[model samples]
Target: MSSLDAEPHAPGADAPRSPGPLLAIESSCDETAAAVIAADRSVLSSVVSSQAALHERFGGVVPEIASRAHVERILPVIREALAEANVTPTDLSAIAVVTHPGLVGSLLVGVTAAKTLAAVWDLPLIAVDHLRAHLYACRIAYGEEAFPACGLVVSGGHTNWYDCPDAVRATLIGSTIDDAAGEAFDKVARLLGLPYPGGPSVQQAAEHGDPTAVPLPRPMMNRPELAVSFSGLKTAVRYAALGNPNSPEVPAPPLGERRIADLAASFQAAAVDVLVGKCDLALKQTGRPTLLVGGGVAANRALRVGLTDLCERRGVRLCIAPMELCVDNAAMAGLAWESFERGEFAPLDCDVTPGLVRA
Candidate 1:
């Protein structure tokens, strides 16, 4: 039986419209993710296959390997999502995919899969911005929260501020002049001989390291503009480890447990201070009462705490996605509902834009 006739429908009332069932795919980076979502922002099924093991030895994600993993896992992930959701292709109204601002090879996998689904099933194609997908995680997290708030997206590859008018429309308000917050975290983690994927390792070590043990400069804190500079902070961390600028590389001196913890506290404090400061400035300029933060860095416990405290003091409500959705995942790709409803579809001529900019 056809899907329409499978479910009972009221006469003359178009077939019962369940929330738009959207299938979303995200391969903008090392993670291969797919999800089935309903129009009301209900996540039916979410699946993510990470490529950390493949690239761990390489320090970071290798585009070619990431693409291969996506190609192999794409079908299985989608199949699993559909099975978990108990939904079929015929039941889906559209397919959404992240098409740009990532490894070209990685982005192509999702885009190709989405286009194939759109063509074979006559489904509408929804092209989602990778960064915007990060912000949409906030929407998924806080269903009833007011939108059009400011967003601070921090990730391994990105650090930027935006005026999010809505899920689909975002304006770039500020961005990094050099390294991203996550990149800096990773670099500092390496400098400290922490493990790969530096954010967490650094957080863990910083918990025991003395952030105040070494005085590090906070970049661009006094700058009048929204632009940020983490390159300097990264250098400071390097100097802290190696001592003098021209000196040979040396191991970081042992600090007492409390001292190590203080260093961690201090490093986190410096990063959090700059982030909070910029976000506060953005909120004041936009006059938006709500602030939303997303991206991998949003998972940082310190950042979350610092932002929350800052927002509380300023009377600005802050909304952040749970840790699960904060990192790269297709569940947040559910924002396709907005694009589908608005009849926004990209042309076949669309190509992968590796360096796509939101600002």
Candidate 2:
């Protein structure tokens, strides 16, 4: 049992005399994070403990390693969040946690911690969807003006778009049928002998290279459907970086720094082209006034430039989360406040939804 179980659940016994901030926790994947947000949606503190180095040897995030790290770092992260916000648990109104569309064990860690704190403090508990939080990050950055927009979330595990009608509710309109764009980035990076956390590494490499030097495929970019595919693109990158074994010229040449840079630029361009095409198609189909982009891949400079140019041409206002809020973090838990406003709290027995949310 948690040591917190020993605390009594007195509804108003230790309640603050005034309304205060909400404690939000996020352990959806490799990052264990926490934040304190005020009643006015101001983030007082946000702390994230990353397990990137721990998973670097594996070239990708391992679920088991991620969950175990969460178990060890969650408390310290939360304590830091609270301290930085200059608030104690007794001064909070409620607690929130991401409980869906993430690694099951990682989600459970945050949920269990949030639930324990909520019970011990006699405060309400809120459940936030991971994807929904990503979308809400745009809202937090741009205020109410960012809503009723088309939201695209591009992370290592998710590549999906939503028809967002409001703050708390959004309908999935499209998604990846095969590998996510970010996943393609990671696998392609490995093919090039690039570092882990492929998105940033690839982006950095692409800077000194020519994006047109590679003939990578832009899978499904020509299709009218909103769904996308990146597996073929990744395979094309593999062939370009490493000679195909079926060919007699397999020993043509090894990947040099210049060649790696060129390949990275080409792969990034192809991926961003498909993404930009989809965004253009989504706007044409939905006619939404705003385009809101979030998630880790949304932090890509190429993507940001592509999206900015697309919005300008289409006369669509672009709203994006600040770079700090682009990655998975507790501060993006802005959706929880929307739920709290509607009194749509979750039950204490709520469980995590472990799979990617299908459109």
Candidate 3:
């Protein structure tokens, strides 16, 4: 039986009883997070311990360091989540954890912690795909009304198009054939002397800049495939910033408020333009009337504005997770509700699948 079929008694005819509340864990990357959500899909409490400061000095996240950080924060984060929700192990009917498609060591910490909790409390266990959870993160942020639409996930780790039927199932349509969009952002940001986590830094700098100032090529723009490629753009941006004579790419020397903002604006424009074009193609191909965007890079204000504008002009409804949920959080574990109803408990055999999916 599904959680939807488990709701309590109705007025006249008996309604289904709701499955018990769920405790969800997420350690897919640098964040150690936990959440308690009810069968009705209400998030009771959510806690996230971020390791951005730990990784900032390195220019990017080191997988091993991220894993260690998860270990340090997992227990405390969960305890905080439970306390904030005013729930105990005895109150939770199931436990759900993200177990795949992320940094291997990082994923293990979450899977191990979740498995231990399930065993000690004798509760059902669920495994959630990290990327899928990103999509569900939208449902949590926008409510169920935001589900069942085609979604475009763009972040440092991924960029893809999906035919989302619901929270648990998504049909992949388009994805990057080379470096992910977020990876490109970081590379470009580094070249520009922007801080780590390039997406935001680049976006901030781009606000006042003229995107037209940099005549960067839009790779795969007219391509027959729906795939995206940002490696060339990143390279172009780098050559421009360094004033490499061999490279045709050119840019005003990085300086002054206006110049910095214009470059930032240009870079952001190029990235978002490609993203929006692909989304337009996806909508045309799938014929889906709604569009949803999520993941860490989804928090980019410029990207959001561009996507929203394209969606509006194309007559497609747009849905995005709130800025807080757009990054990483445990509230996205749809498996919580799934496990509660099906009682599909994981055995001791449960283990993390780091390479859960390529894109």
Number of the top lDDT candidate:
2
- Candidate 2 deviant stretches above 4 angstroms: 1-18, 250-252
Q: Candidate 3 lDDT (Cα, whole model)?
A: 0.79
Ranking by TM-score: 2, 1, 3
lDDT of 2 at 122: 82
Model 1 Cα lDDT, one tens digit per residue, 1-359:
43212332223545656645988999999899999999888999999888877876767677888889999998888888878888877778788899878999999989988887777666678888889888889898887464879988899899989997767778999999998999888777666666778788778877765556678788888788987888988887666655665765665566445544555567777888899889888998888878989999899998998898989999988998889998799998887787887888886557788995755
**Which is the leading candidate under TM-score?**
2
TM-score, one value per model: 0.91, 0.95, 0.90
Error of 3 at 175 (Å): 0.6
Sum up the clashes in candidate 1.
13
Tens-digit lDDT track of model 3 for 61-120:
899999999998898898888889987776677889988888989989999988877776
Q: Tell me the lDDT of candidate 2.
A: 0.88
Cα lDDT, model 1, residue 333: 88
